[model samples]
Target chain A: MHWEIVVGLEVHTQLSTRSKIFSGSSTVFGAAPNTQASAVDIALPGVLPVLNRSAVERAVQLGLAIGGNISRRSVFARKNYFYPDLPKGYQISQMDHPVVEGGSLTIQVGPDEKTVRITRAHLEEDAGKSMHGDFHGMTGIDLNRAGTPLLEIVSEPDLRGAAEAVAYAKTLHGLVVWLGICDGNMQEGSFRCDANVSVRPLGSGVLGTRCEIKNLNSFRFLERAIEYEARRQIEINEEGGTIRQETRLYDPDRDETRTMRSKEDAYDYRYFHDPDLSPLVISEDWIARTRAAMPELPGAMRERLVAQYAISAYDAAALTASRATAAYFEQLVAASSGEAKLSANWMMGDLFAALNRYELDMAHCPVSAAQLGRLIVRIVDGTLSGKLAKEVFEALWQAAGEVDAIIEARGLKQVSDSGAIAAIVDQILAANPAQVADYRAGKEKMLGYLVGQAMKAMKGRANPQQLNEILLQKLN
Target chain B: MSLTLLDVKRVARLAHIAVSEDEAAIYQQQINGVFDLIAQMQAVDTTGVVPMAHAQDLNQRLRDDIVTEPDLHEKFQSIAPQVAEGLYLVPQVIE
Candidate 1:
């Protein structure tokens, strides 16, 4: 029997704020144990939580970006739970009223594009960390990350497969980073995902038991975990056993998942409105101001790049995958008098290779856009051959020197002069009499070999197109 | 409001507590009492009303993409149960 996999994702993005959501304590990670904690963070006696205005504004901005309905008034709820890491014994989260609702994100999976409907994006405070390996048989708590603001974006069960889930996650990661709302750094635990996956028989309406995979931070892990869980559940159902709805943890080392707890072990989280903080009321003026400050998002930028530069959709999408890469492409294009297609090629191919070789980011690239632009222009205008241009690029990248200066210093000008190229072609034909005879006897493909030898003798300075023209004239 | 024996067992398990049979029956009544009060929420029509998740209409705050701190090796090891040359020590498993 055919079965369909249903998946939903709950993504928690750590708000890129300077301080904790409710307190003025620094939200910086890796601080000494409890050093960044304030009275509100640790939930000290008589300490009331004060909402951070910046955190609220950042959520509003994200809601606007995702086309979500920003509620004018929202409330915080205290979710009761007991854990060693949770200093307050309860996490302050959205329960009944979230800040944003009913938005959709479009993710491209395979050759088709699909929109994954987002249920809601809520605000919450993160719990502290427990150091289980520390303190001689006793776990210690670090409140540095406690009360850090998090935007929990939940999606409806619209994804059909593991690929779609991964695409949706990547799109969300890019959007959050582009909106300046979250760094989307999975390694730092700033952005993480909890995926709920279940399978239903094809043409059946009833949903099967769903298992939630918790805290999968990497895209590769999200895909692998969902695939593994779906197959595991299907096998269980086929073996005359009912699948249990439970929370599981993904073990990347083992490449499998283990049951963390059963559904009965789930926390009721006795949620209620927090009394200390006031209702979050958003003003129309604030919305308007935030909207005005919004930058061009990835989708809009990709469309613009495709239309304005006459580049393929694939190239445009690859170029605009990240804000830094898109910015670099734009700078190169601008410097090269709008040679957009060439700029795209260099960025997606040569520039990307260089970055990977040195393990460097585009922002820290040693070669400037203007210098790369000069090299591209030289190749286009026939000042340097394609082969010589590559050498010039390497030299300019190593030392921030002028492209023209490097070309001149190496005496690598292309032999675009017809008379000079024809002389070299004549010498190659004279040396290879058998090749000449073969070319005359309808073996026309041999003409290419003669041109290659001529160019090689010219030390790759001979323009291939000019050499081809001169060689053909000499042969025919 | 009264708590049920089932509610007591479920909540105790969630709370990671091992309840005795006698304690389970006693806490059942306590949980039912809480549920009866919570049943008041069902009286209001929430059909079209969206479920609330948070109180504040706040967005997430973002930071600049810059590393702010140097790598802390010695300090991180200070709290470890056992440490040798900046590395945490754990009991041998394979050998």
Candidate 2:
């Protein structure tokens, strides 16, 4: 019997506000243990939480970006639980009304495109860190992260498998970063995801009990954890056992999901609307103002790129994966006045490969976009063949001077002059009489070998197209 | 609804408070008395009335996102029962 895996993700994105959501304390990471924890963050007796305006605006930006309905009035609720890291003993979150609700994100996995419906994106505060092992049988609590603003984006159970979940996650990550609402840094815990996974018989309309896997900080971990959790559920069902709705943690070291808590000891977070904070009311003017300040969204930009540059949707998607990559491509095209196809090919092919090899993102790329544009221009003007262009690109990657200077310095210019290419082609034809006879005798593949010889004799500087044309003429 | 002895004991456990059998019995009656007041309130037919989250029907005041707090860990940790290397110490709570 085939089982289908169902996944829904709850993404917690730390908003890039300068202060905590409700307290005026520094939200910067890597601070001394509790130095950034203000009186309100530490839950002093008299301190009260004042909502941050920037945090609200950022949430509104997300709502507008996803085309979600922004709640005109939202309320904060307290989730009561007992945890050492929670100084207030209760986390103030949204119970029913959230700032942003009902958004959908389109994700592309392999060749299939699917839209994952977003349930809600709520504004909440983050808990502090608890260091367990090094404190002599006691835990050390650092409240620096406490009260930091987080927008928990919940998705409906629309994803069917691990790949789709990852694609959805990546797409959401890209969107948040593009919107400038969140830094989208997973390493420092700026962006985190909790996946709710369940498995049921294929084609079943009813849902199965799900086990939520928490704190999957990376896309790889999200995929693996879901795969593991779904398999575990299916195995239990097949063996005449029951799947428990519980919370689990993924141990990447062991590559397994272990039960963190079950129904037996599950936390009953008695939720109530927080009385200390009144309802947050957003006006239409504020939404309009935020929308006016919004940048061109990636989807709209991608459509424009497709129409203006006449590139494939796949190429456009790859270019607009991040705002930086798209900006770099545009600058490259402007600098060189090169065809969009040529620029896209070079960027998607060589530039991306080099960036990956160096473990660098576009921001850290050593080669400037203009330099790359100049190199592409060289290829267009017949100064550099594709092979020789790669050689010059390497030099440029090393921060060797301008593209033209590097070509001149290394004597890497293509032998594109017709007379020069013809001479080289003639030399190759004379030296390879047997192969030339083979080509004339209608073994047409011999032309490739002749072309190779001509390129090699020219030290790989011969213009491949010109050499091929001249070589074919001589052979016939 | 009235509170039972078991309900009193469970609520005590959730709140991390210790209660004996006699205390649970007394607490159950007292909690049930409170629930009776809630039952009386629920008896009122206030259909179509909007639910109120707070006493005052007002919007939450917004604050500018500024880092106004300075380093006060030294002053704050001074009052904590246990501290080590600028961190508050507590019995290990395993997840």
Candidate 3:
């Protein structure tokens, strides 16, 4: 029997707000154990929550970006649970009524596009960090992360497999980063996904029970966890064991999902509307302001890049993956006098290679867009051959001055002088008379060898096309 | 919902509260009182009345997103039941 995988994702994205969601505490990551934890963040008595404006605005930006309905009013409910990380016995979260009601994001799965319907996006406060076994016999709790703003985006079970889940995740990640709500840093736990995976008999209308694998940080881990969980469920079904609905944790080291808590320990999170805060109301004008303030979304921007530059969708996707990269390409192409295709090639080729080598972010790359644009301009204007242009690019990376300066310093300028190159070509043809005869006798590959010799004679400074043209003239 | 001794015991256990049988019986009565009131409200024939979540129609006030809180980890952790190495120690949290 064929088994079909059903998947849905609950993504918890930490907003890029400067302050905690309810308190004035710093939301900075990697601070000391509890240095950023304020009184209200730590749940001090009589300390009340005041919603952060930026967190709401960031959530509104996400809603607008996804074309979701932003609720005019949303309420905060206390989700009661007892965990060491959560200082408050009950976490302040939204239930039943969320800020963002419904939306869908389209993802490219193979050659087809699938749209994942977003159930809702609710604003909530993050719990603190609980470090286990840091001491002799106790767990260490760091409240620095407590009260940090989170927008928990729940998706409908629309995904079919691990690939679609990942595509949806990456698309959501790109959109959130494009909206500037979340930093999209998986390593720092800024963006993490909880994938609920299940497998059922093919064409089964009834949905099977799913086990949620928590905290799949990276795209690879998310895919691996879902695959492992799906396989485990399939084996159980084959062996006639019923799948349990439980919360599981993905152990990346073991590459498996283990049951964290079973149905027996399931806490009835007694949710009640908190009397501490009032309803969060947003006006239509506020939504309009946020929508107007948002930058061009990634999907629209990618389409524009493809249409305007006539580049392939793949190239356009690579260029518009990040706003900074797209901005850099735009500047470079603009400076190169509308050389968009060449600029796109250089960006994905040379710029990506250099960034990978240096392990630098595209935002803080050493080679400025203006500087790289100048280099491409030089190549476009026929001053530097593609080979010499690469050499110049390396020099540019190493802080070797401007493009023209590097060209002058390294003497890497292309020799396009017809007379000068023809003499060198003549010398090569006369020296390789036997090979030239072979070329005439239909060993057409010999032409490449003759041109290579002429280029070598000119110390690789000869323009390749000019050398090829002059070589053909001299041989004939 | 019907009141039951076992349901009361389960709720007390989930909330980590010790409930004697006598106290459970008393609390169950009180819970039934609230449920009765809710039932009475639900029985009203005002089908068009929209349910209100709060008493007043006031919206939540927004606070500017600024980092104004100073470090008070020392003060907060000082009052914790257990503290070690700038961390609030608790019974080991599994999973």
Candidate 4:
């Protein structure tokens, strides 16, 4: 029987606010334990939470970017739970009215574009850390992360496979970082996802029971966890065993998910509106200001890149993966007196490969954009073949010299003179008479061999197209 | 619209408060009184009225995003039951 996977994601993005969502505590990561926690963060007596203005502004920015409705008034509710990391035994989260509502994010899955509906994005406080396996059989509690501002974005169950889920996640991650609302650091847990995965027969409208895999910080882990969970559910159904709804944790070491907690009933948090905080009222002017301040969104930028440069939609999407990457492509295009398509190919291919090989970020790339652009210009002007252009690019990366100087010093210039190419082609034809006769006898593939030999005789500096043309003329 | 003895005991357990059976019976009656009062209020036909989360009409006051808290870990940990290496030690709660 055919089975399909359905997934919904809850992404918690730590806002790049300077202070906590409800207190004056520092929200910076990697501080000495509890040093950044204020009295309000630790839930001291008589300490009340004062909402941070910047956190709300960041939420508004996200709402505008997603084309979501910014709630004019929202309320904070206390989600009652017992944990050491949460000092107040409850988390202040929005339940009824969130900051954002009813928006969609378009994600690219292979060549097809799909829009994932966003349920809501709410403002909440993050809990602290519970460091296990230390403190001599006791867990260490660090409240430094407590009360950090977080925007929890929930998505509809629109994803059909693990790849689509990842695409949706990555697109959301890029959008958040591009908007400057979140830093989008997965390592530091600035952005993380909880995936609700289920499996059912194909074309079934009713969704099967789902298991939530919590705290998938990386996209790879999220994909694997969903796949593993979906397979497990399908196997259970095949065996006539019922699926259990529960919370599961992804064990990356074993590459499988295991139940963390089984719920006999839904959690009875007895959610009540926190009387400590008043209703958060956002005015129309506030939303307008946030919309005006937002950078050009990724979708609009991708469309502009495609229309302006005449590049493919795929190239535009890849270029606009991040703001820095798109900026680098634009600068390269401006500096290179070459085709935008050529610049895009080099940027997406060799440039990215070199960055990965050297374990360098775009900011730390040794070759400047202008220098690479000059090298591309050499290829455009026939001063260097594509192969010789790569050589100059390597020299540029090594800071050897300018593009023209490198070509001069290394003799890597393309031999584009048709007269010089014809001499080499004649030498190759004379050296391979049997192959020349074979080519004359309608073995047209041998002409490619003759052209390759001629170009090699020039030590790969000859323009391949010029050599091919000369060889065809001589043979014909 | 009333709390049973079992419901009262469950609520006490959720709150992590230890209560004896005799004490639960008394608390069940007291809590049921509050529930009865709520049921009386719920009988009012107040359809189309928006639910109010707060008693007052004041909006939440916003604070600037600035770090004004000094390091008070030493003072805070001094009152904690367990502390070592600048972290509060709690009974191992890993699930």
Candidate 5:
């Protein structure tokens, strides 16, 4: 029997607000422990939570970006639980109503484009960190992250496998960063993912009982944890055992998940609307104002890239994976005088490879778009062949001068002069008689060897197209 | 409509607080008296009245996005029971 995996992700994105959601505490990471925790954050007796307008505006902006419905009357509810990191013993969150509701994100996994249904994106405060290994025998509590604003985006279990889950997560991450709501930094815990994973018989409509996996901080770990959990469930079902619905923790070091808590230990949080907070009411003017300030979403940019540049959907998707990358690509095309196809190819191919080699993102790429675009322009303008262009690109990667200057300095310009290329081809024919004879005696592949010799004799400055034409004419 | 001693004991256990039998009995009596008042209120129809979350019905005051708090770890940790370096020390919390 074939088993199918079902996954739904709850992504917690820390909003890039300067202060906490409910308090005026600084939200800067790496602050001294408890230093950023204001009186309201530490739950002082008299301090009250005042909602930050920027957090709400950021949430509204995200809702507009994804075409989600902004709730006019969302209420904050207190989730009662016992945890040391929670200073107030209750987390104020949304239970029934959330700020943003019913958005869908479309992700591309290979040839398939799947739209994952976003259930809700609710605004909530984050708990502080409990550092266990910091001290010799005791735990250390850092309240710096307490009361930080987080938008928990919940998705329906529309993803069918681990790869689809990863695709959805990445698309969501890009959207958050593009909208400027969140920094989308996975390393510093700005973006967190919790996956509810379950496995059921293939082609069955009945859903299987799922276990929630918590705190998958990285995309790589998210993929690996889902796959491992799916396998574990399927193996248990194969052994005639029942899958226990529980919460589990993914141990990246062990490459497995351990049971954190079960239904027996699950907290029955007595959820009640927080009396201290009034129900939030959003007006149409607010939505309109936020929408006016919104940047172009990645999906819209991808469509424009396809229509404007006449590139493939795959290439357009790759180009608009991030807002910065898409902007860089546009600048490159502009620098190349609207050579969109060549710009797309170079940006996605050699430039991307170079960025990866240096472990850099498009935002911090050492080479400027104009610099790379100039190099690509030379290739398209017949100043350099593809082979010699790569050599120049490598030199540019090492802080060599501009494309034109580098070409001049190294004398690496394409030997496009007809007389010069013809002389080189003639020399190749006279020097390699056996290969030239083979080229004339119906061994059509021998023309490739003759071309190689002509290219070598010209020190790779020969225009490959002109060299091939001249070499064939001389041989025949 | 009223809480029994057994219910009171169960609630105390859920809260992780120790309650003696005598204390449970007294708590039950006190809670049951409150429940009787709630039962009287529940008897009224009041069906058209919208449920209210707070008495004031005031909108949440919005704060400007600014960092107004300075680092007060020493003063804050002074009130805490345990502190080391800058972190608040606590009994070992696994997971």
Candidate 6:
């Protein structure tokens, strides 16, 4: 029987706040093991947690960006659990009422767009880290990440495949980063996903047992984990065995999932409203102010770029994939007098390659938008050939010099003068008599060869279009 | 509400508890008590009412993408049980 894979993701994004959610401890990662732990973070006796207003505001901004229902009143609850990493013995999370509800994110997977419905995004405190291999025979706890605010975004089981799941996760990552709510860095554990995967026979009405895969910090791992777990469950069911609903951990090196523990139902947590803090009350004015402060989200910006700039959907999506990339493209376009397509190409192709090679963010990009704009202007004005522009771009990227200065220093100007190009074409035709004869005999393929020789003879400075026309004229 | 023998073992295994045959009868009674309370949740008309995962409509807060400090070598290693040079010491299994 054909099997259908059902996937839902629970993404935990660490909020980009200066301090911990309920304490004033610095939310910086890689700090000393216990230095950043505040009184409330360690659950010191009689210490109270004061919710950071900035964290709340960040959450409100995210709700507005995602078109979620902003709750008028929400309550934090103590999720009772026993773990060494949890300093409070119970994690303070939303139980009965969460902060955000009923939002949807649209992600493009392959050639189709899929909308994954978000069940809720709730505010919760992160647990401390337990380093198991740090000691000879024991583990050590690092409280640096403890008490860090996390927004757990839960999605409905609308995803049907691994590609859709990855697309959904990536889209969420981009949205969080664009809203300035999270850093969306998977390596630093700023953004993590727990995927719930199950397999049911096609046309089956009832859902199958699911195993929740945890600690998938990368998009590749999320897709792989879901694919592996879904196949495993289907195999088990086909072999006349029942699927065990449990929590599993993905081992990236081995590329398989092992059972971590049995999944806990809601009643197992014994969730109750946290008594120390009052019910969170967000006002209309607060929502309005946050909404007013919202920047253009990815979807809106993508539409605007496509409509206003007449760029392709792929280019627009690539430009708007990240906030910094979008900002760089917009700045390049603005500086180049609204040459949007050229700006998009440079940013997506050349600029992106350099950034990836250097492992640098767009904010710290070595090539400034102004320098890139000048190079584009030179290309548009025929001062520099397309080939010469690439050379200029590299020089300016390496030394942070002006585009015009680089162009002048290298003497890499487009040979657009008809007389100069015509002379080069004449020399090429004289050297390649047989090719010229073939071209005149209607062997159209020979034109490309002559054009290549002409370009090479001109030292790659001649514009291909002008060289092609001049070469064809001389050939005919 | 009563739990069959199979339900008792499933719940025990799901919770990662070791339940023996003698204790299975007692757990069966205890789980039935818990299930009786949960059965009340089914009585409420939830056909249209959305199941709530959190209390408020808040998203995750993010941090600035700035490197605040260099890698701390000795300070982070100080809390480890064993350390050699800059690496944490672990028992050698193969050797």
Every candidate's chain B TM-score: 0.56, 0.95, 0.82, 0.91, 0.88, 0.54
Over the true interface residues, superposed, what is the Cα RMSD of model 6? Answer: 9.0
- Scored by DockQ, the top model is 2
iRMS of each prediction in angstroms?
9.2, 0.7, 1.1, 0.7, 1.2, 9.0
* lDDT scores in order: 0.82, 0.92, 0.90, 0.91, 0.90, 0.82
Candidate 2 CAPRI classification by DockQ: high
DockQ of 1: 0.10
Off by over 4 Å in 4: A423-446
Q: Best-fitting candidate, measured by lDDT?
A: 2
Cα RMSD of all models vs. native, in order, equals 5.4, 1.5, 1.7, 1.9, 1.6, 6.8
Q: What tens digits encode model 2's per-residue C-alpha lDDT throughout A1-476? A: 99999999999999999999998899999988999999999998988899999999999999988889999999999999889999899999997999999999988878877878999999999999999868889999999999999999999999999999999999999999999999999999999999999999999999899999999999999999999888889999999999988999999999999999997888878889998899999999999999999888998999999999899999999999888999998998887795799999999999999999989999899989899999988988889888889999999899889999999989999887989988878887778889988888899999889888888888888878888888877777
Task: Please give me the total number of clashing residue pairs in predicted model 5.
Answer: 0
Which ranges of candidate 3 are over 4 A from the true structure? A134-136
Please identify which of the two predictions, 3 or 4, would achieve the higher lDDT against the true structure. 4
Clashing pairs in 4: none
User: Model 2 segments beyond 4 Å from truth?
Assistant: none
Q: How do the candidates rank by DockQ, highest first?
A: 2, 4, 3, 5, 1, 6
Residue A370 error, candidate 4, Å:
1.5
Q: Candidates 1 and 3: which is better by lDDT?
A: 3
Cα deviation of B22, candidate 6, in Å: 19
Please compute DockQ, using alpha carbons, for every candidate against the native two-chain complex: 0.10, 0.89, 0.81, 0.87, 0.77, 0.08
Worst 10 residues of 4 chain A by lDDT: A261-270
Candidate 3 lDDT by residue in tens digits, A222-305: 999999999999999999999999999999899999999888777799998888888999999999888889899888988998
Question: Of 1 and 3, which scores higher on DockQ?
Answer: 3
Off by over 4 Å in 6: A134-136, A263-267, A431-435, A438-445, B1-95
Query: Deviation in angstroms for A353 in model 2?
Result: 0.1
DockQ of candidate 5? Answer: 0.77
Put down candidate 1 lDDT per residue, A1-476, tens digits, no spaces: 78899999999999998877887778877766666666677665788776777788788888987889998877788898877567677899987789999898988887778888999999999998765554455555666788889999999999987989999999999899988889888998999999999998987887778999999999999999999999998898778789888999999999999999899877688888876666677879989998898889888899998888899988988888788888888889988888988888887888888889999987798898988998889978889876787788789779947998888888988878888888888899999999999999999899888988998889888888888887887788
For candidate 4, write residues A244-355 as lDDT tens digits. Answer: 9999999999999999887774467988999999999999998888788888888999999999999999999889988888988899999896469988999998899899
